[model samples]
Target: MRHLISIAAFIATCAVLVWVFLPDPVPVETAPITRGDVTVRVEAEGEARVREVVVISAPITGLLQRVTLHPGDAVTAGQVLAQIGPVTPALLDSRARAVAESTAAAAAAAVELARSQLVQAEASLTFARAEADRTRALFERAALSQRMLDDAVLAERTAEATLASARANLAVREKELDSAKAMLNGDYAEDTACCIHVTSPVTGRILGVRTEDEQVLQAGTPIMEVGDLQDLEIMVSVLSREAVNIAEGAEATITGWGGPDLAARVERVEPGATTKISALGIEEQRVEVRLSLLAPAPPALGHGFRVTARITIDMAQNILRVPVSALFRSKGDWAVYSVEDGKAALQIVSLGRRNDEFAEVLDGLTEGATVIVHPADTVENGSAVEEKPLIGG
Candidate 1:
């Protein structure tokens, strides 16, 4: 009985010793190194703008009539948007009235002279015709020479041409008289005002009105702006140094534009750089990167809408990758705690590229190898680890 009791005690002691000496598994989350594809992107905040923007302007120097259309009003081509009349003249006094009357009288006299000249030309033409008829009859009867008949015919044609010229002169004189009368009454008065209707040149919505009321404006003054909402492009301004990495035809992803993520492509990188004040109040050398939408942009995406853009600068396919969280500095080299046989194994990895979530593993890791993400400070090489599935896999 003593021997059996001693054996039982030794066994219990051995069990306690084994339980105390054995290491406990460290709690950790891990993900297997993946071999698939990864994309490297450069991100920026961008602004949406119409591909084409047009400013409507007054074509003539005149009073700018009140614009009834407000901002964001849809318009079509050739739609009359505003009407401008010639500037109304100041009040006319006695001396001004006298001068105007004298000018009107001169115009009337010019018209009378033209009418008299036309009447004279008509009389001369009639006389020439009679003479030509008589000369032709005499020539047929052998009573007059051929040269005389020819001369009479020529005179008749000349007189007819003169009469036509006089008629043209009379028309000009009448127009001049009307113009003088209009000026005397008032420039652009109710009866004789020359009103010009300004029409929309294209189909679009009104962006803004430069002149809102009955303000006098000079010729070519901007009155309004129009731009198609459907035709939209993304303008991303990036640092000039970073722009060198962006190339035309790179795939761009746009988000936060009041719709689904829009697929786009880099259409152009401006050759010139502009200076812009950043949020930090530092002057930044920036270049514009224009993005062309791959699909039709949403109508809600209007001009100056804010958006975020991610441009893919590089891509690696079928390359081994690991979560960026798994990477840590060890012994002056990039390293990770790779799980092997349920123990954290220190690994020195050669990296190629990295993005937000993953880093390209050029060497020192293989597919299906699990790596501890955000390894704790207490964890070290050969530490027993308990693996938890990474969130979202």
Candidate 2:
């Protein structure tokens, strides 16, 4: 009995020692929960591009004899922006003299031909009338042979045909004379006008100039460019995955371009995607999206300027919101660890209208309630934790 008592005492002593020397659980640092409005935004970086750019090119090939206007020169439609090589005085004088001589010669020849044809037609007509009278007189008196009267009638018909032919010839000569006169007038030589008068097609400033004085340009070469700065737009390219969610008339906010945030609306989403090689050498499908500013853009903004855009895909007013980092997948449901007296208490949450950084808290949490952000896996119901201040809090 004494030995049994000693064994029990020894076991009791061991149990007490084990309980007294056990290590305490380690404490975890947690971010403090704050209450404020949280907005979820989708951010994209892109360059600004003009909505409409007009490229002015030479209509025909010639020496760029003059480029009187420089870039930023305001011009008007039909204004002579530049002039090509001018025609030499000697050439012009020779062409004029040749035309005058040719025209005079054609006129003299035409007049002579017309007079001769008119005289022939008149003579033939007189002869035909006299012959017809004689034929009638013979036929009536019966003093002439019938064959002679028939022959006289045939002669009169022949004379009439001759007169008609002569009149037709005169008409042909008149048309020929007009053609000859036109040729002698040197209308074709007026093509030299192409050497001068390069006019502006639209009233705007010159954006580019490709040629200087006396430079020869090929056909269809662009000599200058013009664009209306008042008409401006923002063109942004987005990944195909992101583009699918974007649609026309979506609201967007533009910022980080050296001005106040500007409101913009999506005008169009391009249908096709272009393949672009990323820095990793992976091909990405990108689609262009066009946005129009609802308010006037600052004058300082120019083409190809880089800016940040936040597209509001979803939004809700007066809805409970929580930091996105607080969300965790628990048993196939989104959950957060609510802090109560510096202890984590597991709570299931229903979310709605989630943005990039914040999520709308639809249920399970109230406003001004403290929730643990970035909860650890070891965190559980009734877990002891200490709330620490968040960065930038």
Candidate 3:
């Protein structure tokens, strides 16, 4: 009887120890539903750009002379940027002189063509001037209306400009003819002849110089890019599907520009989509969104500065919300493991607009209600739970 009592007491002590050593509280973390404001936004990477980019091109074909301007150099309107002059005439040999004679003949024919055009332009101008004089006299006598008189005056001015342009063309053709003759005589002095100065069209800093060295270029060849640094905009490429939600005048918060956050607004959403290779080597359909800064941007930030954009598409105030991890699909319906009396109770909940961090709870979950975030498979309805310290507390 003494052995039986001792054994029973020892078994009771072992049972107590087993109860004390049970796994600590399932090792699960918990969060509570709360009332707060939530902003629905699409985050994207973007780059800073100029509001207006201008390209200064070579207006006339010639050999480009010394270009003193460099990138980032301040320039003003009408300031000379570069010089273009005639190409060098090659030294004449017996074969070269024969080629030069052919060129001279072609230049002479061009001069004749230019002279005929000048004569036609002069005749038109003379007629226009005579008609204008007659119209002015009639207007003075109240025979012609002011509109007719103005028309005649405009016609005369246009004709005069045409004639002057024709005369200039004739002079250029004559010079070409003379130069051709000089080339036939083995004169290579055209290389160092007078040059045409290329002037800046706008007051801004040079962004890029396409031709840094002297070289022969054709007319309309691009030379440099100039833009005002103070005038800036942003270019954000977002997924085409997400771009549909964005509209003009939507608010945007720009960050990661190596400065403080800046306020901006969407100016335009491009109508077209383009294919782009993502960082992960996946192809994505993307659309460009243009935004204008609401406040002045940082002075140090220049064109092509990398940035991150958070565009707010929707919002809600004083909405009941919970961490999105607490929600799970149950029978094709949204459900959550609600903790009540320290037990996991399955509760069906309605949801509304959601963001990356939180989901808006419409029903079944209330403020101060504890919900199991990422509940384990064993955490089911009517199961006892020991809540660990709150996540991210």
- lDDT (Cα atoms) of all candidates against the true structure: 0.92, 0.74, 0.88
- Collision count for each candidate, in order: 0, 0, 0
Among residues 3 or more apart in sequence or in different chains, the pairs in candidate 1 whose N, CA or C atoms overlap within 3 Å are none
Residue-by-residue lDDT tens digits, candidate 3, 95-214:
878888999999999999999999999999999999999999999999989999999999999999999999999999999999888778756554456688888888878988998788
> For this target, which candidate reaches the highest TM-score against the unseen true structure?
3
Using lDDT, give the best candidate's number.
1
Judged by whole-model lDDT over C-alpha atoms, candidate 2 comes out at 0.74
| Residue-by-residue lDDT tens digits, candidate 2, 29-77 | 4443344455555577776755666666666666677677787677888
TM-score of 2: 0.59
Order the candidates by TM-score, highest first — what do you get? 3, 1, 2
Please give each candidate's TM-score.
0.69, 0.59, 0.72
Q: What overall lDDT, based on C-alpha atoms, would model 1 receive against the true structure?
A: 0.92
How many steric clashes does model 2 contain? 0
Residue 24, candidate 1: alpha-carbon lDDT: 88
Cand. 3 TM to true fold: 0.72
CA lDDT, candidate 2, residue 108: 68
Candidate 1: count the clashes: 0
